[model samples]
Structures are given as C-alpha cells and as structure tokens.
Target chain A: MSLRRLGPVAALARHAVLLASGALMLIPFVWMVSLSLKPPGEIFRAGFSLLPEQWYAVENYSRALTASPLPRYMLNGVLVCGAILSLQIAICAPAAYALAKLRFFGREGLFTLVLIGLLIPHEVLALPLFILAYKLGLLDTYAALIMPFAVSPFGIFLFRQFFKSIPDDIVHAARLDGLSELAIVWRVMLPMAMPAVIAFSIFSIVSHWNDLFWPLIAVRSEQLMPPPLGIMAFKNEEAGSDYGPLMACATLVVAPLVVAFLAAQRWFVEGLGGGVK
Target chain B: MTAGLTFNGINKSFGGAHVLRQVSLDVASGEFLSLLGPSGCGKSTLLRIIAGLERQDAGTVAIGGRRVDDLRPKQRDIAMVFQSYALYPHMSVADNIALPLRMRRLSGMQRLPLVGGLLPGSRTTQAGIAKEVTRTARALGIESLLARKPGQLSGGQRQRVAVGRAMVRNPAIFLMDEPLSNLDAKLRVQMRAEIKELHRRLGVTFIYVTHDQTEAMTMSDRVAVMAEGEILQVDAPQVIYADPANRKVAEFVGSPKINMLPARFGADLTHAAGTTFDVRARELAGTAGTLGIRPEALHLAEAPGTGIFTGRVRLLEHMGSDLFVHLDLPHDGEGGTLIARLLAERAPQIAFGQTLHLGVRTGRILVFAADGRRVQPDPAPAAVLRSYA
Candidate 1:
C-alpha cells in the first residue's frame, strides 16, 4: 500500500475508537428511556435488553403528564433560570469589564477575590443562605430562588478573561465616541461577549434548572418548586418508587436540556473555548 | 474649523516612573505638529492627556484658549485615530462611522435595538445618520465596504474607515497616535501623503504622535523632538534639521544620524584629527565642547588639514543617489567609526582599508557643551577661512 493511502486507514481507526466511546456514553440514556417505557414488574426483571418486553410508553407518559404538576414545575424552572441568567449577565459583565480594563484602586486585589470565589463550592453557602433567606421572610418565594444566584463568581471570571482578550483600544474608542461606562459595557462589550454569554447561559440553565438542594431548603409551597423538587414530590405522592412514572418524569425533566444542548451544541462548545481567545 | 493647542507644564507618572515631565508645546491653528520621539518617551501619553483619555498628574491643557479639565474625552471636542484603528469588529463600517453621530445626536431612548424604531422622528434621524455615513464613506473612497465588518476589510481599508469615522464628527482638533505604524512600509508612505492632503483640505489643528523620524519630518509643519520625558526642540522640519537645539535633537532627527566628536573649542578649535582652524571665541577660551557635523557636511578631501579627519575606509554603502562611506578614524582620545554621505556622481573611487581624508565645511560644524546643549562662539569666526590656515 502506498503511504498516501494509509491516511484513510488511520482515519478509520480514529472513528472506530470515537464511535465506541460515544456509544458507551449513550448507554445510560438509552437504558433510562427503555426503563421508563417498561411496566413496573419489568423494571426489576433481569433481562439486559435495551427494549422492554412490553411497551408501556403511552401509559407511563400519560400518568407522568397528568398525575403531577409537571407543566407548573417546568414553568417555574424557566422563570427562575431565566431571571438568574439575565441578572448574572447584567451584573457580571460590568464587574468583569471593571476587573479587566478599569484601573481603580484595589482592582487587582478584587480580581484575586473573584478567582478565590471560583474555588469555593456553592454547596458550602447553602446553609447560611437558607438562614438568611429565612430571616428576610424570603423563603417559599421566587426571590429566594433567584436573588441568591444573581451574582456568579465563575461568570465574572469567564467574562473577565473574555473581556481581557479584547484590545483596550476598542473600549477606549467607544469612550471617545461618547459612550459612558455602562453604555460601553452593554453596547460594546456585551455584544462582543455573546458567545460567552450563550455558553454561560447553558451552564446556568442546566445547573439551576436541575437544582434541588437550594429549592428544597427555600421553598415550602408546592407551586414555587422547580423541576427537581417537583419530580421528587411525584415519588412520595405516588406511594412508592413506581419506577415507570418516576423515570418518565426524569426523562421529561432531562429532555429539555438535551434538546437545548443539541440545538446549540456548536456555540456551547465554542463558548467554552471563546474565553481563552 | 481650527483651534490652537497649548500644553502648559504637563507632568505625568505611572507607578513611580515619570513618563512625561513639565513638557510644554504650542501648536497654531490649522497647523500639523508631530511629537517625534522613541518609544517610552511619553509621546502617546501626552497626546492622550490632550485628548482627555489620560489625566495628567499636574498640568493645564487648553485648546483654543478653553480649559477642558472638567470635561470628558467625548466633551473635549477632539477625535483621535488610534494606532490599532480600533474599529468595532461586530459593527458594519457604516455603523462604525455612524456611531459618533448617533451618540451625539440621539437620546438614550432612540438607541434601543427594537423599540427605538417605533419612536416618532427616529426614522428621519436614522435616515440622517445613514446619509451622513454614506457621505463620509464616499469621501474616504470606502463606499463599497459599508456593509462589511472591520474584520472583513483589509488593513488599509480599515484605516480609511477609521479616518472616515473621525472625519464625520468634524471635531476641531484631531489627535492621531502613530496611526500609520501598523501598516507596511509602502502603505505607510502612501497613507502618509493621504493624511497630509487630508490635513490640508480640512484645515484643522492636528497633533500627531509618531516615533518614526521620517514620518514626523515629512508630514508636519513643526516637529517636536522629545527624549527622556521632555521636548528638546520644536521647530519646522527644515529648521529642526538645519538648526537643532541640542545634541540629542540632532542625533535623533537624521537618517544616518549626525556625527559627534570630542574637541577643544578654546585652543584647538577643529576636529580631533590634528587639523587646525583659526579659533575665534574669546569668552569660550579654555572651555571644552564637542564638535558635531552631519554626514552631508563631510566631504572627501585631498589632504588632512583645516577641519579634515583622515581615516581608513571601513565600508561603503551605495544608495542609488548617494554613497555612504563609513570611515574608521584614527583618534587622540575619542574613538568610533564616522559615516560621510557623498553624492554618487561626486564620490571618488573608493576601496576598503584605503586611507581617506574627510573635510568638514566651516559653517556646518556645530559645537555642543559637555552637557549636550548647543554652544556657539562668543565672537564670530572668520567666515572665509582658507584651507591654508
């Protein structure tokens, strides 16, 4: 074989390895969907087959849809996540611009504080935040849900890196053209940081929409509960694990995220890489 | 259309490092003044201070006899073209050019993305902005690139767009910070001429900052030679060349650079090559100064006498019009190579290692004190001294 012709073989081997790993990742998703469509008796049965012996897709989906307040949970999820993300961008972009470009006193020290914030886990703040929200009479309200997540240290750091990558001349040019500092942030920096915003948006939506811990502590009302808390309620109210409807709820809860990711997977991936540029 | 700029007692420092020190300059209305200096000489910082982009540690910047210290950069009535061009990457060329007009003319509510279009009179305002953008683009010969983003255009095209952006505002003062430094040499030369023509047509005050001596010398009405955070000399291009105020100014202005050799002015008044001239400074007697001569002032001589220096030829560089002869001089105290620019037609046959005599003309010799300030004789030397002296 010619040396030039060996290129295809190398490419073929690369694809084979990739395909194997991809399928490995897909197995759990396939099994979850398969299990959700099975009857309760079939879930515990040891058959290793991806397809259930009998189809209960319609029955399980109908119960998952009607037997609980799934729509309300999804609605609450959307509202809370949307508010959190909007506030994150509005608050973080200016902070990042200040951290990256402005030369105020203690600027470097403040940026160090932000970097240190990234190392801390949000779970560590859960207890104190819950107590504070309780003291402020904010528990069981959307304010408790959204207000705490408004300022994101990671978002600030990401945006600061992205902002730093832009040449200072571009920002100064905006100022020369009569833009105030806020106008420079929104009109110039935000538009240029859209990729990062989208990337961060997905991250924010995924993490917060799926969040159960904070909502569990903050909410006592069922209507205020997001998807994770709502799905847990389905388990307790249905009087057991009742694997079919529960898995169906899990499938429904995860489907929106998967679809969103698939819709903008390219931007999501590029958004992750955009900060370095 | 024009206003003179006066920079009085400008001082600046960054992190304890003094960048500009008591630098002062005066530029007449409609005059093109270039601040010429090496990098880190604070030329750009001075321009920024004038533009209000930087705040001086202590100074007063007045444009057209008006104090603008309380005003911001936008309120200063000055537009600056940056070295990077600094065009908005996301905005179309038309939008980039329209931005200054929009910011100055439109209210905050009229600039919103979707709702701004619904407001009454915004349509006509938008139309006006568009028309002005088109007119400016046409003036700059970039009408075809209006729809293109800055990233889509070439460097020269982007530069024209940047200039077009600055021109649309019709500001009284235009500041440019080495705007041509980013272009290739040929394009830089081409754009240099275009900018000069633009300055002529606009007739506005221009304070341009550049480190390239050729750019400053070829383009400005007055060139300020700066070093070590201060302006050493400010004069017309020809005047700056013919009569520099100090040794540093002379050394920085020319192409091959001015030549300097240590010499005694009171007793031994000629170059240190053992050649002699009738010394004439009664007050400068027994005082020491260095002899300065340009490369053009030195001519190939037949013998070593009367302001002549003899040295072996080190190298010969033949530019199309002139031959640069590098001579390694024999010395009493100072030692270095000397370059003499001789015309190609007048240059004698030359070779390496051949001893040559260089004669500096009488009036062309400039003497500087030990501190590098230009020093003149108290009594004028005989204007017509023969080589026989």
Candidate 2:
C-alpha cells in the first residue's frame, strides 16, 4: 500500500514517465489557446512563453466571427448534427431492438451486412454517394449533409449490444403487460439503454460536426457550410501571416464538443465502453 | 375469478428439431397446476406459450373458454412471474406493480409527470390505481418495500413485488415459469407455501412450471409430469406419485428415484430377477419388463425368501430421517448399483461389502412394458383404477 513498498527508483521512474506523457498530451491544447490569445506579432516569437504578453482575445474573436459566416456555419453545423442525431436515435433504436429481440427471416444476414458497413471506409463511398446525391438533386442542401450520415451502422451495432444485455424476461414481462413493440422499445429498452444512447449521441454529434470531407463533397453552397468547412475557409483567407484569428476560430470550433463531453462525461465513457463490448 | 386453460395439439420446432411435439393438457378453473419436468423438457416453453410470450407452430390456446391463439399477451388477460423476478430495476416496487394498470388504464399524455395530473379524470384514475397497488402490496405483505427499487429489496421481497404486479392487473390467469427457482432453499420453500396460499386466496387459475418435483408435488392441486415436451401423465400429486402412468413418471416423481431392475417373466406368472427370483410378474407374464420399486418400498430382509433378493451393501448415505443404502445386487449388471431407503429407526447397522437380503413389497411394485408404458394386471385394484380416474 505504500509507495516505498514498490521501491523508490521504480516508482519515481513510473511517475516521471506519466508526467512526461501528460505534458505531451496537454501541450498542443495549451498552445492552441495561448496562440489564439496572442497578438499577431508575438505568436511566432523566439522566446518560449506559455502565456501571451499581450492578449488579443477580443480582436481575434471578432475577426474569427466577422471574417467568414462563422455564426451561420455554426447554425448549419448544429442543424445538420441535430438532424443526424435525431434520425440515428429514431432509426437505429428500433432497428437495434428488432435485431436484438425480434425473430424474422435473414436477421443474421441483415446484421452481418450492417456490420460490413463498419469495414468499408466512408471515403470509398464518397464517389458513388456524390453521384447518387447529385442524381437525386440533393446536392447543396442540408439533405445531402444529413441523409447519408444519419444511418449509422456503428450506432445500430452499439445499441444492439446494449439492448442484448437486457434480460429477455424484462421484455417478456413488458409484452405480457400489453405494450406494443414501439412502446417496449421507447418505454423499456430505450430508458434502460440511456447510457448507450447518450454515448452514441455524443459520437454521432461529434462525428457529424467535425466531418469536413463529406459536407465539402455533398454541399457546394456557402450558406450550407458547417463549422469545420467555415473554419477551413477562414484559415485560407487569413493564412500564412494571421495565426491568431485562425487559432481563435479553431478554439471556438472545438469548444462546443469539449463542453458537451464535460456535461456527459460519465455517460460518454460508459456508453463507449459498453457499446464496444 | 376462475380461468381454465386448454392447449390443443401444441407443437413447436426450432430450426430442425422439434422441442414440443403435440403437447396437450387441460388445467381446471381455479386449480393450481404444475408442469413438472427435467430441464429442456419444454415446461417453460409451454408456460410461455400460454402467457402469449411464445407462439406455437400449430395449436389452439384457450383461457376461460375463449381461444386466444391470435390475441396479444396483454389482450389475453394473463400475467406471468418470471424466474429472475423480472422487476424493472429502474422503477420502484410500487411503480413496477402499478405498471400493468398504468399501461392498460392510462393514456400516453396521462403518464407524464406534470400534465398527467391535469388530464380529465386522470387524478382519480391514478389514485384508484395507487389504492389498488397498495391493496395488492399489503396483501402480499410487501407494502413496506413498495417505495424501494428491486435492487434494494431481498429476493423474497422482489418475488412478492413480481406477484403483486401480476395481482394488480387482476388477470384471468397467472402463468409462473419457475419463479421460485432463483431463491435459496429455505426462501424457496417459504415462498412455495405463500404462492400456493396466494393461489387459493385469489382463486385464479395458476399454471406453475418447475423442474423441482417437491415444489410441484407440494403446491399443485394437480401435477402434469412432462418429459421431452410431452405430458407423461396429469393427476393429483399423490396419485401421480403413487400411480404414475409410465416408467418416466415413476422415476421422476420421487426423491431417491424409483429403483428400476430389469426382470423377465415366464408364462406361469413367475417373475425372475437375474434369472432366479420367486416374485410374481402377474399381468406382465411372458414379457421383459422393468420392475420399479420405490426405495422406501424395499425393506431390509434377514434371509432370502419369497419376494426377496440378496445383495451386498456398496455404499450408505445417511439422512437424519432416513438412510439410503446402495446395494450391489447379484443380478445388477457389471458394477451397477441398486438403492434402498430405510427409516432411520429400522435401518440396520450395515457396512459396505457386507452381504444383505432385500425384500420388495409386491403390491407396490410397478411394471413397465418395453415401450415405457405402464401395464396393469387383470381385475385392477379399485384404488389403482380410482387413482388413475
């Protein structure tokens, strides 16, 4: 129970390794914020300064906001991510419940096909998806941004795992009480699987929010650009010399995800771990 | 309320193998019926089918004289208590018990926390439901534990809440699938009596399933002995134990299962054990049959004589109330053993490897044909026929 029992040299070595790794992870985040707050002149200064000498937070933030349609981009990101998340919950939950509980033909085959989605990279589907979207006249619209991302094979598989862990007797008991299939999913399985749903929600929200490639390919309108695309545009316009406003915009882009994670830390960890199993 | 259940030609198949093959039985109204069998005997499956949790491939299920083959579980007016208790972990015992009522009586908007109270007559209906739940909980002696969750309660308390949930719905039939299987021995025994008493008090038809013969024999008004998805026999517990319809029933019904020694019968009604016993096979003459003698039916004899066989004591298992003696009979096949139960007082001080004489009660002997069916002699005793009836 005592550190001395583990031997001083070995314990010190372990502590040193842990501290070094911790600093390695923290340095980039610290630099991102510090550079965002620094004036343009001090950003690339030779001397190492963890904190900037002159704070240009307000100016950098205003520039970040006004330089591009950051507000509209944020709105679009929220709308698209929200739409995908809602669709995932609505579609994946019942599908998961069916896969876990229902008896039908080709169930295993269907599940295997859904799992095949996990094996295929999203990039591989970009060309075919782009063609399909253009043929359907869904390009330059939120439909293109939200449609393909909404159906998550990973979400279905995660919810299915969580749903399977629930005792079948509980579902049977609910059935005997006269609950419909939808009611059983919503009132019983869904509530019991709250941690998983919350966890998958975070995944779905973050993935769609940070997704740059799909949105870039599917959408051509500037008005429909999400936060990540907007940040790219802002970076391009103020590249080479202006790192302050770029960092500020990057910070803003990551802030919402960090806040969401902080709010749902417990459920996020539980869901992620539980879903994987 | 009394609701009798009838299953007609019930058949179930999984993939290729048939688990239940044309299983049929009738449970009388207000009667406690137990489906007793070994594991994988389809007792639980039959119970689930009755509860509408499982659909039979080919059959008609009727509860209280109405065919419910197409009706959903809730519409069938039947409630089931599962082996795991199946109490909703998230809900309080009160909420769990009241769930059936809430689902049946309350609307979607009426289940909400705030607006539910404002709905027309929702307040009175909710109060009535609560009152009924309280009454049911008090009846089950679980009223004090109602506010607590399932994890907070003891096994027995959770079981009572499960039963209370069934009671609040006032279902026409109660289907219990090994509900007491998860409890400790002492609690299982205690709950067995309580469940039987509850069945009597409620006067609802109860179809209870269990692999434990003792539970089936003690609590049921009538026991249906099943094996491999087929009911071997259905009769009152004492009758089922004393006069089983087949060899399987005779072996399954008793503790220290009936000792089945192969015997060959001559045309003269003389039964020979290992080619040399003087016992009579009467109705079973001229055929090879298995002679089933209950452990308690065989008494320790002093010398070989009529109705007696000589054997050496192989092992002894002493219970406080009885003694189980494994005897190595001369006729017993290569290293095979025959067991006998003796009352503690009458049990002799027998040691292993000691030769002994065993006497079987002729009247208590059971004869099974090659096909596993019980065969009775001509002019069957009135009591035997009466028991069967």
Candidate 3:
C-alpha cells in the first residue's frame, strides 16, 4: 500500500526478469554440455533432462579430439588471434595517437574515415578481400587469415578515445624530455592506456577466435583452419549430424575464451569503463 | 651553461583567434623574470615558444644570442616544469629524472627496454645517469622518493620531482608554467622560497609564468605585466608597483588592488571625487582620465576641507595590523567607493556610519590617460596646490 513497502516487490520483479534473461542466454551452452555427455540414443530422446543417464563424456571427448584435429584447430586459433591482436595494436596505437594528439591538416577527415570504416561491416568487405587474396596468392594460408582483421577500426576508435583523455601536458613533457612521437606512443601513451589495451585484447581474441565467416572463405587447408572452421568439419551432410562429438567440439572451442574472460574480468570492465570516462 | 632568452615579435593564433600578438620580451641571463597576467594572456604560449613546444606563426626565439627558431625542444637547451607537474605516472621518480639525461646520453639501441641494459657501454652510461639522478634528487630533497611512482607521492613531492627532472639536465633556461599554482597555500609559500633558493643556486634564467601577483612580487627580479595578448609593462618588482607604465599594470600588481576614481583634467588642475588639486598635467588637459591611488597612499585627514575627500564610512574590516575602511562618496563624486587602510591601533575608534576625510600626499596620485597609459606629472613645479573644494 505504501511506496516504501513496494520497494521490495519492485526489486524482486527486476531480479526475476534479469535471472530469466540470464537463463535464456545460458540454456544453449548447458544443452550442449548435456548432449556432449549423453550417448547417441539419449541425445534425441523426448524427455528433457540435464545430465545423461549413461555417461559417454570420455567417448564423445575422445572422438571430438581425434576425429577432426580439434586440438590443432584451437592451436591455430591461438596463433592467428595472437598475430592479429599484436598487429592491430602496433598499427592502431600510433594512428590513434595521431588522431587524438597531433594537429595537422585533414586530421578530422581521416578520423571521419575511421568512423566510416567502423560503420561498414566486415562481411561486406569479404568479397573484395577474398579477391585481393586470390590475386596476391595468399589464399589458403595463415597470411590470408591473419591479414584481413589486422587493422581494426574499433581498436583505433577505442584507443583514440582513451588517448584523448590523457592531458596534453604529458605529451608536451615527453617531447621536451627528448622523446620522439613514436616513442611517446610506445613509452608513454601505451603504458597510460593499459586498461584500454587489455579490453581490446579480449575483444579481438574473442571475436577472431570464434570468427567462422572469413576463415571459411579464405583458408581451405584444415591445418590452417581456426577453431570455428575446424569445428565445422564435424558436420556431415551425408549422415545426419553427429550431435555428441559436435557438441563436445563446440564446448572445447568456447572453453578457453570463457576462462580467459573470467580471469581478466576486472581489467575488461575497467578498460571499457575507461573508454567512456 | 646558462643563457639569456629573447622573444622577437612572437605571434600565435588558434583557429583565427589571436592568442599572442607580436609579443616580445628579453630575459637576461641569471635573472628571475616572471610573466604575470590573468589566464588566457598568452604567457604560457610565449613560454612554449621559448621551449620550442608550440610554434609561433611569426617571429623568432633566441637563446644565448643564438637564434633557436628551427631547433626542437630538446635541442633548444631549455627545460620546463609544467603546472600539473607532468611526471610520467608509470615511471619511478628516478627514471623520470633520468629521462632527459638518458635521451641525451644513450643511443636508440641502448635505450631499448629489455636488451638495452645488456648493450656494451650502456651500462657505464646508465651508471653515470643514475649518479646524476640521485644527485639531482638529493638537491631537490626527494632522494627517498626516487623509487616511488608519481601517483604515490603528494602534490608537493611530485612538483619537486618534476623540478628535479628539469634540473638534472643542467639546461640554459628554465621555463616554469605556474608550477606552484597547484599546491596548497602554506605549501605554496614554502615552495616559493625553495624555488627562489634554487634559482639563486643554479643562476639560470627562469621564465616563470603565474597569475598570482604575490608570487611575482616576491620571487621575480623583474616582472612583465601582460594582458590580452600584450605586455603592458616590464620592470623590477618595486618599480612595477611604484611606477607602473599603465593603469592596467597598477591595477594588476597589487593585492588589495589600486583604487581608481574617474576624473576630468583642466588646463592646470585635476578634479576627482568632489575634490580638485593643482597637480598639473597640461598634456592631459581637456580629457577625462583615471586617478589611481594605492590603499597605503591614503591617510586619515582631521576634517573635510581642501586636499581631502569626505565620505560616509560604510564598513570597517579589521586585518590585525591594518584596518580597511570602506567609504561611500556623495552623488556629485559619481557615487564612487574608496577604501583607505589605517593602522589598526591608530584607527581603533573608527566605526560604521562615521564621516571621514581621506587625504593623499603630493606625488602619490598616479594619473592615467583615457587609453590607460600613464600620464607624466609636470616636473617644473615642486609646489602642490591644495584642493579648494
């Protein structure tokens, strides 16, 4: 009857909605785990249950590991993501520094171009990038996989915003102390913007590790395929899909990112929060 | 290693708005010169031009009789302590102080992060730099803080570290852009003395920019009063106070502020605030001007008569040593307000609503023309004709 007493009911309602949405997001991952541990007969069973009556986790995991080089795919994912993240930082940090600190002609226009680059989806650039790769004879190679995502507009935007927040006094101080412009980026701006860097690393690793589209179009060799493409090898059209091994591969592929995100959750939040601040 | 600095017609503008307009100043070697002004007066901009941080659109900066317009900030042989004490947040205080030396002493290869320490000859250079950093830190009284990051130190300690960073290189000139403005009042006074002592010990030309008149008056050998992209006056601290070149300089350099009364000048007499005096300035005749009187220049007169201003006492502020008496003038005197400072013990009985006549001695009144330039008093007459009010 009183507004003060209605506070608890309102809070309960808000938490209930949040929990339901959280459950909705988590159901598919839970189902995948359940299916990975179930025998083939139970995967398509009518009754819904969390755990498999018969434990076939070992069999399903072994098949997923050996059937299509799932471990090799995860390794490839690490290599490709590592290379992309490094190249992105190297290219983006200086570009962002220039856009944020330096005064020059056409600077706003160049930054506008970067904003435009953010608006255009990577899927839209696939055809042109694929043709260029073919012309350059970079198809079916790690170069093709690593090169396309090297210059990330979002990374540049994130770093530029972060660099802009830093006072101009520091930049002037560095110059007076005999630091070159590039050295300022390496020694000063990068260290000061560490939170943004960690946040960007997580974003790049997650997006590229799970990226299926570009790798599918560019690389044909199973040796060079990233995790998403490697997992696609589990699907066979001739026979109905093998749900057990497929779900096992999906769980394995998503596991590293989840663990990494959990470990770096603090820096991740600080990094994104720093961008807005 | 010390040098004089000269700004020759320096000019700068941001987006078509002029920030510095043909501003020129000369700081003699070993002199402590302060660029005193309100904010946005382009003092910092001029200092930056000297440091080669910001390029002026026109004019050249010279140091030690050599033109340095084409030189970089590092090549200019000058150092600056920024207002924010812009110490590198990540680097320790030792590393921060050692940076200018390292940049000068080490090759690009030897300055690399991990492998540079292993480079041949770099070890010796680094040892020398370490010795220098420690010496500079000790001089600044921050040797114990060498291992701490700037974020861990108090504001005063950080300012000392910034000064140490500048002083380690032993440059020709030191340009400080309001370095003391960030400290608390007590700390500011303490550091003010320390900085003055540092200047005396180093004997380098210091171009300190500040908006605080007290800092300028106490520390600077000479002060250049600036306003709105122009220098109004440049003289010694005492001369700047006693003999300001313009009305702006008179109003800017004092704490309680010089009181100004609007006046009209006749052929041989000046009339102000219902009182007329035969202080002759024939060149300023037939024009309206301002009569500038400092608070200490005013004294208590016994009664309202010639050579005295009569007003009703509005307020009395007891300042321990001196009492400030605010007076409200009559309607014919343009309803002006005046403040006269009296020795507190001498004027103990002064109360609100009392009528007082304030008198000024001869030659104490500063006359300014309509354009704010000082109007020289006539030198021929040593005589003062008291006001026939």
Per the 3 Å backbone cut-off, how many clashing residue pairs does candidate 1 have?
Answer: 0
Error of 2 at B244 (Å): 1.2
lDDT of each: 0.87, 0.86, 0.91
Q: List the residue pairs that clash in candidate 3.
A: none
For model 3, residues B1-389, the per-residue Cα lDDT tens digits are: 99998888988999988999889888899999999999999999988888998999999899999999999998999999999988889899999999999989999999998999999999999999999999999998999999999989999999999999999999999999999999999999999999999999999999999999999999999999999999989999999999999998999988678889998988877899998865678999889999999988899888887658899999888899999989999988787889888899966577799888899875788999999989887743533333321
Q: Estimate each model's TM-score.
A: 0.93, 0.90, 0.96
Our model 1 lands, by Cα RMSD against the true structure, at 3.2
Rate residue B85 of model 3 by lDDT.
89
Instruction: Quote the B-chain TM-score, candidate 1.
Output: 0.95
Q: Taking chain A by itself, what TM-score does each prediction score? A: 0.91, 0.91, 0.93
lDDT for each residue of candidate 1 in A1-277, tens digit (9 for 90 to 100): 6656678889799789999999999988888898889988889987677788899999988888777788899999999999999999999999999998998999999999998989989899999999999899998999999999999999999899889988988888898999999999998898888788888899999999999988888887878889876467557655667778878888999999999989889877877787523
Model 2 TM-score, 2 decimals: 0.90
Candidate 2: deviation at residue B52, Å? Answer: 1.9
lDDT of 3 by residue, A1-277 (tens): 6656668889799789999999999999899998999999999889999998999999999999998888889999999999999999999999999999999999999999999999999999999999999999999999999999999999999999999989999999999999999999999999999989999999999999999989999988889988876567678899878889899989999999999999889988998888422
DockQ of each: 0.79, 0.78, 0.84
In candidate 1, the residue pairs with backbone N, CA or C atoms under 3 Å apart (3 or more residues apart, or in different chains) clash, namely none
For each candidate, give the interface RMSD after superposing the true interface residues on Cα: 0.7, 0.8, 0.6
Scored by lDDT, the top model is 3
Worst 10 residues of 2 chain A by lDDT: A233-242
